[model samples]
Target: MMTIMRNTKLSTRTAAKEASHERIVCVAARAIRRSGYDGTGVADIMKEAGLTHGAFYAHFASREAMLAEAAGRACAEAAAAAADGVASVPPEQALTYMFHAYLSRENLEQVERGCPLAALASETARQTPEVRRVSTRYIKEMVDLVARQSPDWGQPGSHERALVSVATMVGTLLLARIADEPALSDSLRAAALQHLPVA
Candidate 1:
């Protein structure tokens, strides 16, 4: 009975630790997107998560580790959200939905729930190799997911088109976010929406 109780205690401890880790990641993910990876700090994440600063090291190896995991989590969440938007529409219209959904004013304004690709992409090259690796992995996943929705999917050039579309979309979002004037931002989004190969 003592051994069984000890085992149960161990399981409970493990589960609690995992939950804490997940909470940290969830908080950090929003922090990273709202403020660039470099702008997000451990204290901010811990505080946002309602966790004490000292408890952070117990959950993650370091700030970079948290950022890497958070970036992966953020990217995966964004992609899944986009994929769901695509799935609701017909295949031929999937890319159109993706384009508008991604370029939507709501998406652009919702920094807390926006795309990690658009937020951290330019900064990835300067980040730790691990962070860059995680970003690359998710970007590839997004491109593949987008490719699947393209009208020419399975054709020789479909992937290339998807790559261009993803690149254009990210660039557009970046420019829109950086623009000082709302009109310029709207123009940037509108131009990309009209010119990009969404169909």
Candidate 2:
């Protein structure tokens, strides 16, 4: 019975620690999205997480380390959300869903909670080498995921197609956000979607 109690206690502790780490990642992701990578500071993330600066070292080696993990997590969450939204549709329909959803006004207004790559790409270029490397890997992973959803492409030159799709979507979102005009944002989404080939 004593052994069982000790094991249960250990398990609870481990679970709590993991939950804390996840919280830190989530906080960092939001901060990075809102303020860009360079604009967000470690102290700020820690404060937002309700954690101390010293506790940050327990979760990450440095801010660059945290950024690397946060980038991957942010990308994975966005991709997973996109995948879930189109899971039941055919590949062609899935692509359409992704394109429309990405360029939609709802997505544009929630930049901090939307695609991290689109939110942080410009700032990521100025980050540490590790952050840049991780960001590159995450972008490639996202591109590959989208490419796999292209029914007409059949893998050949799919990467290029994915690049074009991502570039167009991100550009549209960025431009719409910068313009800050509701009608222009709607027009941008419509125009961008109109150009995508229907499979």
The candidate maximizing lDDT is 1
> For residues 22-125, what per-residue lDDT tens digits would candidate 2 score against the true structure?
99999887778878887888888888888888888888878888888887777777877887877867766888888888888788878778988778867878
Worst 10 residues of 1 by lDDT: 116-125
- Provide the overall lDDT of each model, using Cα atoms, as 2-decimal numbers: 0.89, 0.81
**What TM-score does each of the candidates earn?**
0.95, 0.87
TM-score of model 2 (CA atoms): 0.87
- Summed over model 2, clashes come to 0
In model 2, which regions exceed 4 Å deviation? 1-9, 155-158
Could you tally the backbone clashes for each prediction?
0, 0
Return the TM-score for candidate 1, rounded to 2 decimals.
Answer: 0.95
Alpha carbon lDDT of residue 7, candidate 2? 100
Residue 87 lDDT in model 2?
Answer: 84
**Candidate 2: lDDT over CA atoms?**
0.81
